[model samples]
Structure formats: C-alpha cells, structure tokens
Target: MIITLTLNPSVDISTTIDHLVPEQKLRCAAARYDPGGGGINVSRAIHRLGGKSRAVFPVGGATGSLLEQLVAEQQIDFQTVPMAGWTRQSFVVTETSTRQQFRFGLPGPAWSMDERELFLNTVLTFPKPIDYVVISGSFPPGLPADYCAVIARIVRQRGARLILDTSGEPLRMAVQEGAFLLKPNLGELASLVGVDKLELDEVEEAARSVIQRGWCEVVVLSLGPAGALLVAKTGHADQRIERFRVPAPTVKKQSTVGAGDSMVGGMIYALSQGKSYEEMLRFGVACGTAATMNPGTELFHKDDVERLLNWINQSGKKVFLPVADGIN
Candidate 1:
C-alpha cells in the first residue's frame, strides 16, 4: 500500500478576471476549489492515472470539513487527524487578457507539539504495512525541522521506501537521515549541495554528490519544460550510478499548477507498477506535460498521458545519457 502525508493541506480556489487595473473592484468568475497541498494533489493525480494511494492529513474548522468533502468527492481513500486550528486556503487568479496567473498562499495555522505527535502517529501506525510512504509538501509553522528526520528513521525501521518531495530546512534534515527517492527541482537540488545556483551542465554532478553522501538512493531532478534528469544506484554496495534524461514532449500550454505534483504522482504510480526507472521517468514526464494542457488544478487526462508516453517511448534512444564513473 502507498500512503501520502500532507502537513499543511489547503483548499485551493482558482478563478479568472477580465483585467487587473489600479486595484479597482474586479469582478471574478465563479471559483473552482480543489484539495490543495503537495500530497493531496499527488493522490488526486494518481487516481486520475488509474492508481490508488491513501492520503493522510489533518483537519480543522469548517474549511477542513469542506476539504474532507472535496477529497471524498474525488473518491480518494483518506484518514484525517483532528486539530484545533482552521486549515489554510490558497488562491490562484488568472488575468484573462494576458493569461498571467497570480497565486496567493497563506501560512497554515501553527501546529502544537501534541497535535504534531497525533498526526505523525496516525500516519506511521496505519493498519496495513505501507509499501511507499510519500511525505510531500511543506511543514506547518511551529513544527521542528527535525520532524522529517524522525519520520525517516521510523520509516527505515519499518523497511518502507519514503519518497520525499519538499524543500528548505525540513528537506535538508530529511536528506541527512536518508530517503528512498527525492524529486527536487534544480534550485532545491543546488540548495541540498550548499550552492547558490547551478548551471545546466552542473546538474548531474550535484545530484551525484547527494547520492555519494548516502542521503538518497535515487534523485529525479525536475527541469520544468526541458524534462527531468534521473540518477540512481545500480546496487546497494556498488559505487557506480545510472543516469537518464527524458525530454518533455511539446504540448499546448494552459496552466502550470500541479505539474510538479503530477510528475511525482506519475513516477510513484509507475514505480508501484514495477516499471523500469527509464520507463518511470518517461511516464512521469508524460503526465506532467499532459497536466499543462488543462486549466486550474484539473491535472491530466489518462488519454493525454498515453499519447505523450507513446511519443516519448518512440524517441527512447535519446533518453539514455552515457554512463559515468562511480563516486570517487
């Protein structure tokens, strides 16, 4: 079984306006609401791709109730931990004229120590043995940075792979303790290696450095439109690493919201299906590219993913990058 944890989930509301002038009364269209948060979006995307994952998150107040209703409406299996504070809401407004999107986010209500313990216990103590524990999104205010590291330790004890997709200090802490896989963008990957920024040619070395240090077994560096770079070990005791780069298939762009989560969701689904690392990257890029063809947080359709995957597989020869020497 696959389980996802979202520490700071939100109700994502998206709408459009004709224009944005000098802050005059801008009448917006009817709003569209979806369960917003890294793990929630990943679970929704997995469901859309004909896969299943149990989503675990906390809830509070009326907004939290609404979020539960939304998740239920999507037919996702979920378990919620109760909290005293209200959940946060995020807004995405698009200017119809220029097609520019503006996203406004709120820092979620601070979580108390007791509340944090309850939430963590709920996640780790699920009745079924979890095959993959995906802890995505950001930590709520007041949670310690070491929280992710603690989870990593416990997950290791249970012998389940943890696919961590997050950023900043919490992400760094998790890396120190190690995870099965990490999907960080170029910027986040640079931060992991203590760099301000990285050049395109420098991506492979930076990713390899993380693996060499025993932080993560696999690193999938997301490159936005250019596609993704994957680095992983061929065996446990082996110093050698395998690398692959899959280019994104061109598509008519609409909205970029949820594309990263869609990529993670697709990759996790592919992994659960016993696909090769190369096939996982290909299918994942297909899902992410397909997500760009929709507005708001609608994610991608299975048909679009299939068509794009076929196009990607037909060009598989270009996907494999030449193997490089082991960590020295």
Candidate 2:
C-alpha cells in the first residue's frame, strides 16, 4: 500500500477576481476550498487517477477539522495525528483579466518534542506492509532536518521504498540516508549537486551523480513545460544507469500549484502497478500537464490524464538512452 506523509498540510482557498487593482475592494467569485500540501495533494491526485493511498498528517483546531472533512469528501483514506496548534491555510487568487495568480502561505504551528516522537512512532508502526512511503512538503516549525533522516531509516526498516519531494537541509539529510526515488526540480537538483546552476544538457549528468553516490535509486528531474528526465540504476553490479525523457503536452494553462505532486502520484501509482520506467514517466508527465488544465488546487481528471497519456504515446518523442557510462 502507498502511504503519503505531509508534515505541513493546509486548507487551500482559491478564488478569482475580475481585476486585481490595489487599494480597491475588488470582489471575487465564489471561493473553492480543498485540502492542500505536497503529500495530501499526491493522495488526491492518486485518487483521481483511480488509485488508492492513505494520507497521514497532523491535524488540529477548527481549520484542521475542515481539512479532514474536505479530504474525506475526496473519498481518500487517511490517518491523522493530533497537534496542539492549528493547521495552516493557503490562499490563491487569480486575476481573470490578466490571467495572473497570486498565492499566500502561512507557516505551520510548531511541534513539541513529545509530539515529534509520537508522530515518528505513528509512522513507524503502521499495521500493514507499506509498498511506498512518500514524504513530501515542508518541515513544520521545530521539526529538525534530521527528522527526515529518521523517516528514511523507518522506511528502510519496514522494507518500503521512500519517495521524497522537498528542499533544503531536510532534503539533503533524506538523500544522505538514501531513498528509492526523488522528485526534484531543476533548482532543487542544482542544490543537491552543490551547484549554482544547471543547463538543460547538464541535467542528465547531475542526476546521475546523485545516483552514483547511492543517494537514490531514481531521480525524476522536473523541468516544468519542457517535461521531465528520469535517471535510474539498471540494478546491476556494473552500476549502469538508464535515462528517459518526455516532453509536456501543450494545454491551456491554469494554475501550477499541484502539478509536481500530481506527477509524483502518477509515477508512484504506475510503479505500484508494475509499469515500466518509460510508462511511469509518461503517465507522470501526463498527469502533471493535465493538472495545469484546471484552476486552483485541483488535480487532473481521469479523462484528461488518459487523453494526455495517449497523446504522449503518439507524439513520437524519443526516449534517449546513451551507452552505459558506468559509475566509478
């Protein structure tokens, strides 16, 4: 089973105004509220893709209750750990005239030391075997970077693969502990490799470097509209890696809020179904691109994903794999 852990989940509120003029009481259309955060959104996207995943997060206060109700409405199974402070809320406003979007986020409440132990224990003691454990989103206040390393150890002990999507020191710690898969954008990739910048051609080598260091078995580099590149080990002692690239299909763009999470959902779901690496990347890109077709924190629809996946399969974009430059 797939289990997603969102350390700092939020209730997302989105609305659109005809014009976003400053110093004016501009009216907005009716607002839409949804459960938000990296892992939570991944669970939602997995559900939309006709898959199941259990979302695990801490909830507190009235806003937390609202978040639970919203997640329930999506028909996703979840488990929550109680927190002393309230869950955070995120706001998204779109200017209809200019097609511009503005997002506001609040920091999550701090977690006490006791609370941290309980949360870690809760994850470590899941009743059933977990096929994949996805730890996404930001670290809540007072949650140290090493907590990610602790999580990595838990996944290892449980014999489950870990899929990580985060930034900064937490990301570094988690990578140091090793993971099955990592979804990092270009900027995050550059950071992981200790570089200031990375050109398009430099991406493959940078990703493979992470694999060579035994940090992760697979690195899916998210390149936004340019699509994604996958660098993974072939599982032989030779330390050879295979690479594949897929371009994002053009669509009427909306909001890019949950596209990365959607991509994670799609890829993990495909992996659970025993799909090939190329198929997984295609589905992931399709789900991510399809998510851009909707506004606000919404994920992709099943129909849209299927259509986009078919398009990707027929687009004739070649999957590039060079001769094995065996890891030293």
Per-prediction TM-score to the true structure, in the order listed:
0.97, 0.97
Q: How do the residues 85-194 of candidate 1 rate in per-residue lDDT, one tens digit apiece?
A: 99999999989899998889998889888998897787568766778989899888988998988888878778889999999999999888889999999889999999
lDDT of 2 by residue, 18-65 (tens): 888889988999999999999999999899878899999999999999
> After superposing candidate 1, which stretches have Cα over 4 Å from the reference?
319-324
Worst 10 residues of 1 by lDDT: 319-328
State the weakest 10-residue window (summed lDDT) of model 2: 316-325
Best candidate (score: lDDT) = 2
